[model samples]
Target: MRDSIRLRTRARLAYTACRRTRCSRGSLRELSAVAVLITALSSACENPLAPELCGAVADQVVPAGGAVSVRVCFNDENGDGVSLASRTSDGTVATVTVRGRVVTVTGVRGGTATVTVTARDPGGLSATVSFGVIVPGIVRLTDRHGLMPAWSPDGTRIAFLGRVPETGDTGDGSIFVMNADGSGVKRLTKSISAVAPPAWSPDGTRIVFTTRDFEIYVVNADGSGEANLTNNADWDVYPAWSPDGTRIAFVSDRDDDIEIYVMNADGSGTTNLSNSHGRDDWPAWSPDGSRITFTSRRGDDIDIYVMNADGSGVTNLTNNPALDLWPAWSPDGGRIAFRSGIPFSADIQVINADGSGATNVTNNPEYVYGSVPRWSPDGTRIAFTSADRNNTEIHVVNADGSGEATLTSTAGTVFGDHAWSPDGRTIAFSSNHSSSGFHVYVVDVSFFGKAAKRATR
Candidate 1:
């Protein structure tokens, strides 16, 4: 009934208007009468057009501490004055300022921000164009295939290995020290071969790195007081300092088989901890300095083993048939994260410190063999590389294989070991994003995409 009444009312109004206009011969005659009525009803004091806004704005990507500029405008035919301004919805990611028709956005930190450019006219008409300004969370810090990034204990400086001057692209790299912000990169030693992850002393005053000549060398943070810890080395690599800074555990093949060796901080009193018959490498000390975990191949399948600090009480941790390598101890010394499975299809798994309760954290089996598991300083999350197709990405997940998040998605990109900052805010690693040269890179963990999440407790 309501529908029929509304239809009848509309028909009656149309017929009345058509008759009142006195020219209802055709549909065009009635339409002309209605046009006249519209002109009469419109406000005579207003202009016909509001404002024509500029076309869509493009998304802007800027590095942290960098700035970019974009232009926007409005077209108003009313002869009214036009004014423009820009604002950012998230100042922590980016901030914007407007000058005339231009809008300049500066990246404050990693993440994404929404920038809105608004234009207004004197007739109370406004037009706006909104776009995103993104600051990449994973930023390339160094160039030319920089590898082996290690943060100083103080977190104000970073020690890494990268191509040095005069070496060009032909040489491997050398030890380097730089400010935490990627500035003040100074070469600390000569060129090296068979590079390993450098270790910084607990006191933040010394750095231990491997050289090309199969020797372990220690130098002051300022590139002085260089000393060969293993003068007659037979492939000594993976130098890691103990928790108390009294001894350094490293991998050496001096004996018939590769074994883990510990030496005093001053390059004296070297002792072999792993007297295994098979390969042994990647030594990591527990937090309390009472135990060391390493990759060993004493049995048919490679596994992880933990031994007392004084080279006693060796126990197998991962009893898997596949190869398990790159053992990294959690900060609290309660768990260890390592890479498991065979090549081309490996997963990162975490096992309890006492060699029980093993859980696979990265179930994806596409990661390359180099995805070493690194635990955050808080020991709540594990960061590793995940490869899909041919591209590898950095990803983080909880210890129990939950809350997985991708930190990087660069195509055809390979990565190195991950080093967590002491404060657990950023992760340092190596990437070849520049195409020509691999360099050191840092990724902000707390901020992933367009927003920042509170740290996982």
Candidate 2:
């Protein structure tokens, strides 16, 4: 059975690569680095010398009690290496050095190393190739506080809500910003309640977010000129920017019931979309600005709904008995992710754009309180906040519901709720990241790169 499966996979990949490059049977030998995926297939066929146990062309010998790097090559024409770094069993990847076809692994206590590689074409066809390495423990991203994280478009900076604990009489929340590596912490906003959910504009220059009272606001990237975009007495929260940065959409309760609304870049020309007598909150715009997905209680249960930019053709994309809210549009605009179930026991769920194939990505039943599922710009993964009061952390998973891992490790601090950068590389969220108070913080997920190569770096 394994042999047949391997043969089928190789044949499929060979056929795909052949078709993509218009290569004839004889051209297979002439082409280098065909981007064909090879897993646990045997080497009994042609190229019998190819390494099977390691999933590469050659293997490295690590000295006992010492560490060494191993490199793998997929194509000869592509000078770039496969770059399958070290990964923990939980799916966090460690940083690796790539030199041509060789990847160096450090700190080897002598154990099997397993990693995955991914490649893509212009037509969106991709493949994942897995290989194993022997090494010791690999470092990963750990949570500091349960703060909301947002990555910068370029993956350089993360804007998040930082938490400042009450100091004697201080009871205000602040906004915090930092690099993806959790260094260079700086406070962005100061207030009495909370300044949460700092979302970067497409250019990464301005941020649109909400204050504790649910007033929409924007600020410069350097934490200056914080201005309230919506000075309304009612709630105006969850601000999302249009793909083109010309408009912003958010959920407002100005009409008594929560409704979706859009406004100009400078916070003018506000227009309501849902116009429903029921409640609707959490408006997430598609990458193209053609549609918006949000959470609404219009039906018997809280479900996900997608509507045209003009507020026409509203459709409930998720109709499950379990409550669904906090719908986040994928970067490709093909999927919507949201939190389902009651507050204390919610789970992260995703559905197709047309409201089909809704899957529970995080099947954890250990009181998984989820919120704000954001997709990577590459559309390969989603990040969300998961918590159970005592512990809160940012978690990421493959779009197809695999390779789940945690990003934060801070205990006692509550964390979750976020927005991805336009490039799908960073996440912005609100949390009490530190004892200072509750503030906004950002995290860069660019390090993860892609699922096949996603390991802590």
Compared with the true structure, the alpha-carbon lDDT of candidate 2 equals 0.65
- After superposition, the stretches of candidate 2 with alpha carbons farther than 4 Å from their true spots are 1-146, 163-171, 179-194, 342-346, 388-390, 406-414, 418-457
- Candidate 1 overall lDDT versus native: 0.78
lDDT of 2 by residue, 235-292 (tens): 8988889888889988888988889999998989999999998898878788788998
Which residue ranges in model 1 land beyond 4 Å of their true spot? 1-110, 113-136, 143-145, 167-172, 191-194, 448-457
Tens-digit lDDT track of model 1 for 1-457: 4544454456557767777777448865666566554443342233346667747666666555557788876787655668987778899988899999889988777787788877888767777778876675877777555887899999999988776556454445578888999989888876344376678999999998887787998989998998889988478888999988989999898987899999999989989898878899889999999999998887688999999999899998888798898898988999999988887788888889988998888776445546778888778888887677766667778888886666654555655677889988888877665667677888887543334221110
Query: TM-score for every candidate vs. truth?
Result: 0.69, 0.61
> What TM-score does model 2 achieve against the real structure?
0.61
Q: After superposition, how far is residue 119 of candidate 2 from its true place, in Å?
A: 36
Candidate 2 at residue 195, lDDT? 60
Best by lDDT: 1
Clashes of 1: 4
